[model samples]
Target chain A: MDLDLDAATLDFRGEVRGWLAEHVPRPGLPSMDTAEGFAAHREWEATLARARLSVVTWPREYTGREASLVQWLVFEEEYYAAGAPGRVSQNGIFMLAPTLFAHGTAEQRDRILPAMARGEQVWAQAWSEPEAGSDIAALRSRAERTDGGWLLSGQKTWSSRAAFADRAFGLFRSDPSSSRHHGLTYFMIDLRADGVTVRPIPQLDGEPGFAEIFLDEVFVPDADVIGEPGNGWRVAMTTANNERGLSLRSPGRFLAAADRLVDLWRQRGEPEWAAERVADAWIGARAYQLYTYGTATRLAEGGQLGPESSVNKLYWSHLDLGLHETALDLLGADGELAGPWTDGYLFALAGPIYGGTDQIQRNTIAERLLGLPREAR
Target chain B: MRFTPSPEQRQFAASLHDLLSGADTPGAVRAWAEGRPEPGLKLWRDLADLGVTALRVPEECDGLGAGLTDLVIAFEVLGYHAVPGPLAESVAVAPALLGDGERLRALAAGRLLATVALPPHVPYALDADVAGLVLLVENGAVYRGEPETEPVRSVDAARRLFRVAGTGGALGATDGSAFEAGVLAVAAELLGAGQRLLDEAAAYARQRHQYGRPIGSYQALKHLLADVVTRLELARPLVHGAAVTATARDVSAAKAAAGEAAYLAARAALQVHGAIGYTAEHHLGLWLTRVRALTGAWGGGAYHRARVLAGA
Candidate 1:
């Protein structure tokens, strides 16, 4: 297998490198979890959209370059390497946009994608309820048929970015008799609709990084339904796979972190105790990058992602946690204080718990990929 | 850039796998351990006839003229079969060290067998009794030697290790690439061994019943095997990527990752097999011991980690 980027990819890299160098916000935008920071990040996203750099792999009509997946990876590498601000609209642009392109009707795409790309409408995932964190199919959220739309009634907890997001998309049981992945309808709901409430939840770093969304008979127009009604389970799997796969946690972020880790180790006089761990972190990141390139190649060759996404999710979760843990270990006593390392460590702790808990991911890997028997439900 | 193996490479691996599946590799491994090397050597010749021995040798030397990536694919299949030989030395390292020589031609043609002792890290020669040639590498210099040897028992019975004494005239000066190739070969082998362990354990878990159901249904067993699967899957790309790059740092990184992943798989496999895996009669023990032996074969995890950190 060849590791060298083609001339076209190299040229794309140069273009993205040049553009990001010039337009990436200096001093970086503030963390997007806070309300003010959210507004600033949204503005930054608008600037990116204006420059047609918000979604490099999407169609040009959606403010993208229609770039190849390899070029998109290159763009991510340059973006993270430049120390750019995190995407405030990632939940929309990365997770939802792909699902929309794949399953949304043409009208839905026209109405939602460009706005999402421009950061005019930020999205949050509303899949997990208080009782349905990992076993999401056990969710009791219901969307009942109404005259012109459906009335959504449910509670969705751990809805990341929901506190500031304009809308949310999730699965609701549309058929009263259905249970466990059956007869669910995927709907996009306006957070500002009547009978909806969003309560910001303080995370480990004391930021409102997630929120609890309560829908009490919130009316959603039929136009907002993604894919056919009563087939939400199949439709939502695309978004879940995206969440756990390459689109959400690109290897660029980890590679950038690894570089920073090496720099930290060098600055700390290369402490003997931390050296192996530092090397391991770097190696893991490199392995992930190569694996992702392989995956991108496979997808480009028309392969579909399946249970293998669970493997990726399990890997990056641990890699992220380990990288941050090593950074803290190098920081020593100062790591106890509030800093980027400490903040990142706190965030990394959430990796294994979100998108699907590690336990659930393990089960998926075993039952699906390995052809093992399913455990008792 | 393509990261997965090409279709041609996959076909080669599949062919090798078919041959090994029918080769009675376990019997050959046992025969070798019992000091009957003829059976194992016969299988090795069969592999050589498949051009496994000639992969990394240059075309000028009457060899296949393939790259390290091809050697990695061959070595991984050999590891999966637990093939009993100094495969890394004969197939990968010796070609890099003895490039274009008559001895290289003989080695590639399967007319000779070679074993190496690279000092500091690899102070012992493996299968020197069966080898037609023995080489010593010290401080970047290669020397032809018929050094005195003292037997050292290995955890893997299929492997016969010995400490060498006395060095002969210098053959040539070489860079670190040969050593790095050796490391990458071992990493590939470790990846294969880990994959085998995962496969065996997964199959066993599917059939072995406990608590009135297959053990595979238990989360404990499922999670254990799943962890191994993830480690092996992630480590594989590193092995292939290292073969592509063949730099010291890349090779060392591959070795470190493959070694750890394989060791973890061994542990998980034994755990999943329960008492049966501990018995000598089971083929699982053969792979278990082989993985243990290979984990520190070229260089242990700590050494590879230091190499990676040193940016070598």
Candidate 2:
């Protein structure tokens, strides 16, 4: 019920505001999918790592500030408000870090987290295969038990960040006899290992934002296995929730976009019929910001992250798309030209498709949150 | 900072739910729509005994003197039950305007029912004939209004609207806090109404069969209802947040979101219920039409959005 921040949170917010104001790059960074931009974005992550801002919620030993979730949210708000560069280590920092903290061993955390925080080991996700888009449990990737580790052999399409990321993580079929979410093992695999081939795919924006990771027999050490071997389904479920939840997409990003959209509307002479849409963007963003604060508070109160995460995913993805579309509508004829607005609009298209498609997220909300009848697959 | 409801707030809402659940609210609403205010007024008296109408009245006025958050908590439950009356007017607007007086105490004690017409924002006095007091707000001035006029039928049959005319000198000066409180109060009602619609739609989907299976098992209807729940869930926090902050910017944002979310719920519920929901005899129409009425009651989406644009 209380919305006022404590003194410590306010102080932490002031510190983050000052740091972001001074260090955030002017003119912003290029797309992290490109080679030069990837290197530049990686350097930016290293700079943030030195300041312990790269992973604000991680342990201090891993270059994090040991910040509470509220402070982490404040950091994100300031980070986006300052127009900071995209996180080059987001795959590991946002997605895998939480899973590792929850399911990986202490040794795995000590070994992997510090490097990830420092941007020394960038990671991509190898979840969706050509045949296993939304129904990710249908993945055909197999892992055979070897002398010291497991040998992975499968093709993973839409492997985000694999175009330049150092390592990737995915679920693997380990028992050979089981299928469909059974006997699967979660593994962190090196992209540069022998028999691994990364074929970069140009997105609609003509950037290698994602790739296809083909593996003949990529070796992953036993230390890389997350949770129990057969319980990979359970472990991967956590990652799915994280991917679709507040970790991957906080309301800060949308709030920032909303501010930018409002500015755009003013700059464009406030076109008719666009006022409602533009204002709607602001409304949706504020609603989302408040919604996430509630979510963070619930999580802090020891609430479990469940299918409610899909609610966040479903809400923001549509909001993001609508915001960008509003920006384009404000641009009018210039909207057709390939520019930042167009680039953002194209990127927002992925919002509905990735991190579990909106349709899939909606189904999760209906069945899990509302206790509706499950779809007869 | 925390945005979740407190234990007391949760308990208050639960008690309201308990009382309203047994109040036979549908029958009361039907009576009120037919100009028989006895059933609805009886429920109002019971709610007042529970201190529902006294949430915003100051302590000196013999009331609880609670904050806007508490008012919204009460209003939300009232909307969930589809309670018929000048609820926002009596509980929120009246208390905010005519503070620390016998009128306020009377409202707090449920001895009086009131309605107001604030020009531009609220041009019509809702349920004016049944009200013990009808007021007009114009140019920061509050005046007594004549309410025994021709009735203007509202979208929701239970809401009796009258074009109230200002008849006397200013009773007092207002800083327009009443309108702001009314905005947030109406937003909470819209959110609750939408939530009820979503819940009913979900329940219907669970039982209503189509093609040898529950219609909820169909992806098309399921996805439609799912989107409705997402919007309503996100909108819920906005109303709660605005209630806590009570800022003009936050209030507008809350109203805009709740209005749109409620309309979406109404549409999705009607689509799910098909022809049955379209019938006035069905209870779903109460929530559905109440949502439609409340979305534009205090400040329409466009007006609120303009406020948001101005503040943003």
Q: What's each prediction's TM-score?
A: 0.98, 0.98
Expressed as tens digits, the lDDT of each residue in B1-312 for candidate 1 is 888899999999999999999989999999998778998999889988888888888888888989888888888899899999888888888888885479878988888888898988888888888888888888888887564555688999889987776366788877978888888889999898888988999999999998799999999998998898888888998899988988888888899999999999999999999999999999999899999999888989889899888882
Residue-wise lDDT of candidate 2 within A171-245, one digit each (tens)? 999989998999999999989999999999999888899999999988888998999887898998887888888
Query: What is the Å distance of residue B60 in model 2 from its true position?
Result: 1.3
Per-residue CA lDDT of candidate 2, range B1-312, in tens? 888888999999999999999989999999999999999999999999899988888989898999988888888888889999999999999988885499888999999999999989899999999999999999999999998666799989999999988887888889978999999999988888888888899999999998888898888988998888888888888899988888898999899898888899999999999999999889999888888888888989888889999999
Complex DockQ per candidate: 0.79, 0.85
**Candidate 2: clashing pairs of residues:** none
Superposed model 1: Cα runs more than 4 Å off: none
Per-residue lDDT of candidate 1, residues A36-98 (tens digit):
999999998898889888998989888888998888988899889988888989889878888
The reply for model 2, stretches above 4 Å from the true place, is none
